[model samples]
Target: MTRRALGRRYLSAWIGFSAGGRFSQALATVILMFAFGQPTVQALVGSAGTWAVLVTLVVLGGLSLLGQRYRIEWHGVLPLSLLAFVGYCALSVLWSEYSWVALREFAATLGFIGLGLYLALGRDLVQVIRASGDAFRILLVVALGLEVLSGLVLDVPIPGFGIRGDIAYGGPIQGIGGTRNFMGFVAAMALVTFVVEFLTRSVTAWRAVASTALAVIALMLVQSPITGLAMIALAVTALALWALRHAQPRTRPVVNGVLGVFVMVVAVVAVLAHSRILAEIGAAGGSASRLALWSQLRVLIEQHPVQGWGWVGTWPSEPVVPFDVVLAPSGLPFTSALNAFVDAWLQIGLAGMLILLGTAVLAFARAWVTATTFPGVAYVWPAAVLVLLAVTSTAESYLLHGAGLMVFTAVLVIAARRRSWRGRLPR
Candidate 1:
């Protein structure tokens, strides 16, 4: 064949692969794997791995999106809240003191968002949950296996990947997540996914049970105070969802109202009893460290209280102003403000922070309503997952630009597609 014909032939074949049904499911799995494994890949393979995965998936996801473009509802397809959040982040480049950093970070953010969009839009709700369960299951298992090797047999720390090799001592093991708390957070998320899978009949009962066990074991080993808080929130949300699902249709309004007041009461009590809660969860020291970090961040945020330093999604490894101004209690530079909201306020300012919070608030409201009213157990998954993410973000900065952001995007798309008013318009 002539070179032109050969090139055309390859293009057609690529298009076919991208549009395949099986390929879409596989893409969802891989996107999550990459999202969750990013820290591990960065630890072991360096920045090149990050770029390679980002670039390859960006090109591939974009092509796949194009191939199946006709299937998606083009009229009001994108979630406006999420779109606005991202747009605000992108606009930060205009006034960013570190223009190059802003540009670089925005590119990475787009890459994550693109993959998340593909995962959400390419498949149905059950498929996304299955993909999530599978990713968490695989990562948790691998993490445990490595902890065994490093902590049991080898008895040495894998510093490069941040595996502390303390499993033998009953772990606060970092695993592949780069930190004990992060692994705990992921495992807690896994527990939420696995429980939903069981309730929805997405997986066999045995499989669900096993997955839940694995997640629980991992969570215990990590012993993260932040994750303890997440578990409590998840447990409460799960009970609330269970009650909502079983309530009589006509009486659900009363149930919802009561639940709303209960949630408020709990919040007020939590604030009043924070010292006891912190001690119970063993978070007093971690809480103190975080408060210190937040205090420093507050001083920095005051400099450009309205506009912010710029949208560097994750802090630079090398110290820079604002980010450089704050250090961990360990006397090292902290990667995040350790709180997603504070990070948002520091990077994008008050307006951007409001937009971000608005986006999450709308998403959770929509998701909670869907869970109560929607027929399937799968409807509850997004609501419960959002609870975990929201509660976890108060203590950690996971919801920004990596696995957490991708997860937030996927669920936002899922819940929004069903509950968004835009869906009411004629296509």
Candidate 2:
């Protein structure tokens, strides 16, 4: 074949991959789990291996975008609010205390945004959701397989990774993921995806059941409190959305209004009675620790409330805010504010926090509206996922990195799509 023909073939493959083809989906599954999975693959092959995987995916994604003649449509194809938030993050590099770190994180953020945009623009919502589900299925299987090997056959913790077989106390199984909480988070997401797939009849009943069973089993073994709460929140939100979807059109506005009011009231009450509530839930110690950290973080925020210290993708190795002075006595490994909102404030200041909050509020609102009125079962997944993210973000800084950032981008893309396309979706 001619060089041009070869380029065309390569482009076709990249596009297929972006559209959630089997090969691309498999690669994505690994990429998503790489960092969390104790850096298992990274330990063997070294950082070079991880870099190679990332570079390959990035190149394929870039080729896919070029093949589509993709254009960045900030207002139409993408949400302006999200763009504003990301732009602020990039711009913060100027005022950031750690400019180099900020720059690196900014680049990574852009890369994730690009990947999300490629998936959203190149394929319909159904295809993206299905592709994500497939990726999750693979991750779930791999994680569980590793856990079985570690707990049964090998009968020892994975070498070099420090993954232990804590079969007692519901396991605390790290699986391939580095931390039990991270594994639980992945499993929770997989459970949500599989549930959606089954509800929509997108997969064979047996396959759906098996996938969900694996996810649930993984989640149980990991025993992450945050994921457990998130699972419940997701279930409640999904059921409510289903009910709203079936309600009369005219009643939706009224029902939504009532629900909004109810949620606000509950939020206010929770804030007022937070201490007692935390005590009741047996989370007083954890909540107190978070409060102490928040207090210290607040002092730092006030120092530069408008501009912030800088956006480090992950927590800095060194003390950026005298956290060591305040939190050292507690002996808590408090790397983050334990909340995405607070973390955003600490990293980019109050203005950045508002932008992040605004982006989330608008995206969730749009997703909720579309899911209820879009006339298809598949529309519900984004809304459900958003709810789960929101719940998780309260206690974990899941945003601004890896799977969290991708999900955030996907929601924005789904929310921005034209309503006219709803009719084109499969029933």
Candidate 3:
């Protein structure tokens, strides 16, 4: 190969390594190291990691475009997904409460979309997910060790370590997103990745250690309603998938049934343990506030129902439409709409809704096509994870914000682009 070709190959390998879900998970833990105590600071600084990753993506994309020669010849669903996103952006501009803020947020979203497409076209998706899984497991070990030391130093209880909080410190090496929701998401990914690794390979002491640590983190997330519930749901789905792959000839149905039962039992237990999450929703006083906000969106939709709100607002206090005070906790200057679906409605109206819906269809399409074709690939599970994030988004706003949205958008791109690279790329 020419020098240029050699350079491209090396870059491709680097991107592939970074693309893994496990690597992302480790990166997430490092970001979490920064986020733990100061929620606000965590939100701000945590984004730097994603921003850095995006920069890397852009650089690789530029390289690919410049005689880099990367191509993906799959069905055209990716194009449809891209078109829906663009349509949402246009409609958002037409119907937004704050066009400028909406535009900025939409721009970031577009950036993620670009990165996803780049990954799909430029490198091996399976390798990315596998590497990510490995990195994630390693990081879980570190997180567990940190939890133990921190608990001991601080005299606060740490679950697996059987120690109290003393050693925990906030910085880039530790915390990523401060709240339980974000942490829960990370823990869920870690646990699922560990399980997948175990099924695919052999169980080692490290896997056991990581699994225990992840469980502790998961328990702590019971309070984060969106994260906790979404993860539990996703985990159950993953277990089912695992069983489908590894089930005995006669026991396949039995395993599937048992997985279903497990989901039900855990769900009931989660609800019982974290009734506060439900209480908070109930306290929101029903749909009155949401309806009031929807009224403004309704008008925009009538004008262009196909593309309702058109990227309109991101400022905390700004409302895309008029909403009752009931929409948020009283006296707080501002809070997110706390619903990605509502945010989509307010931003693009009906057109935006179509785009949102289309994205979901595209997600399932990608996952199903991939799972059917690749069967048992490590990256397939992230598809269910994308669904989890989407569902929880209806109840929480973090996934659209600084750290949460950025990280998720990247992974979504990775999952969406998954195809068999076995023969195409030299493994």
Number of the candidate with higher lDDT, 2 or 3: 2
TM-score (C-alpha) between model 1 and the true structure: 0.97
Task: Give the TM-score (vs. native) of candidate 2.
Answer: 0.86
Candidate 1 lDDT over residue span 1-427, tens digit each: 9999999999878977897888877878888888888889897768878899888987888778788888876566679999899999989989988898789989889888888888888778899989889888899999999999999999988889898899998989898899998898779888988998998888999999999999999999998988888888888888888898889999999999998999899999999999898988788988888888888888889999988889999898765776776777668888998899999999999999999999999999999999989998898888988898899889888899898898889889888888889989877
TM-score per candidate, chains pooled: 0.97, 0.86, 0.62
Q: Considering lDDT, which of the candidate structures 1 and 2 is the better prediction for this target? A: 1
What ranking of all candidate models by TM-score puts the best one first?
1, 2, 3
lDDT of candidate 1 at residue 284, scale 0 to 100: 91
Q: Say which candidate scores most in lDDT.
A: 1
Q: Which ranges in model 3 have alpha carbons more than 4 Å from their true place?
A: 1-57, 64-68, 71-77, 94-97, 134-175, 202-212, 215-222, 242-306, 312-327, 333-335, 398-427
Prediction RMSDs, each to the true structure: 1.3, 4.3, 8.3
Tell me the whole-model lDDT of each prediction, alpha carbons only. 0.88, 0.74, 0.52
lDDT of 2 by residue, 33-58 (tens): 54334256656676567656656666
Query: How well does candidate 3 score on lDDT at residue 204?
Result: 71
